[model samples]
Target: MGKIPKNRDEALWTLAEWNLSKPEWQHFYSPQLKSDMMIRIAKEWKLDGVMLHYNRGCEGLSLGIAENRLAIAKAGIPVMTFEGNMGDEREFDEARTMDRIDAFMETMGLKRELLHA
Candidate 1:
């Protein structure tokens, strides 16, 4: 893993390692602003899908599951939520996760071939 930067400038420099250019820099810097920007990018790139992780541990930072689902659906893409605790094995229930994913795929009419690998 790369070292976490101590400040914003150092963080931007570190992002350069991932080939992110200065013109594209603003997107990485501000996440609250990034959602709308990403919706625009999705349309511009002709993307067929979007996913939002309604993470358990990071619930404070994440848009709540209902709103996230609504936003993605409004963008005309299928959205699914998987509940998993970051870095906590005890909180990650694989069976429940798979069930939610399966139900979501079924409701969205996603083919088993497309979803199951």
Candidate 2:
């Protein structure tokens, strides 16, 4: 869901069909396609890092996330993953997610800052 299409073909398929490689991941998002897209976008935008939300009920989408994180880290930016479920409030863990987020920010040398001073 985070990757930006690199070309017209990708844009069309990614947006319209989700371009996912297999059927295990979510019905909408393609884990394989998204992994590739994220790697590219992180490089293109010079991003500081990436975050992966592995839904508890969506094993299909979360299956290859570890590999995705590895490939993304190869680009020299940190990648963080946390647990949660889509549309299921009971599966969400606020404290754990927050901890991972904090760790990611610390790894990236980021700190809370005022948007407008």
Candidate 3:
């Protein structure tokens, strides 16, 4: 505050003062913030499904990923959570990832239409 408020009712705050007026500085801390943002983005862009990534090494980000996936799926769209590590080659498995992706697509009513003879 520029100065102490003269009275309890004199408090005034602006988004700029809270450092939330900038795109990079703004974030929603609400319980459903992440889920809401994802749903909104998908709806706004007319997305069919959501593929969420889960990095094994990042505990903080990986935490509650299952809950997040459930919330996203509750938005009436298919959601997929793929497990992998950013820089760990051992965690990267093409066959498993592709299989999961294929299964997710099938659950979303999508089929692999291309066939090689």
- Highest TM-score model number: 3
For residues 1-117, write the lDDT of model 1, one tens digit per residue: 269899999888787755542325434454424455556667898766665565667645454445545655777876666667775768888898778777777776776678877
Candidate 1, position 13, lDDT? 77
lDDT tens string, model 2, 83-117?
Answer: 88886989998988887787778776665352112
Better of 1 and 3 by TM-score: 3
TM-score of 2: 0.64
Pitting candidate 1 against candidate 3, the one with the higher lDDT is 3
Q: Estimate TM-scores for all models.
A: 0.53, 0.64, 0.67
- Highest lDDT, which number? 2
C-alpha RMSD by candidate, in order: 8.9, 7.3, 6.4
Error of 2 at 58 (Å): 1.8
Model 3 clashing residue pairs (backbone)? none
Candidates, ranked, lDDT: 2, 3, 1
In candidate 1, clashing pairs total 0
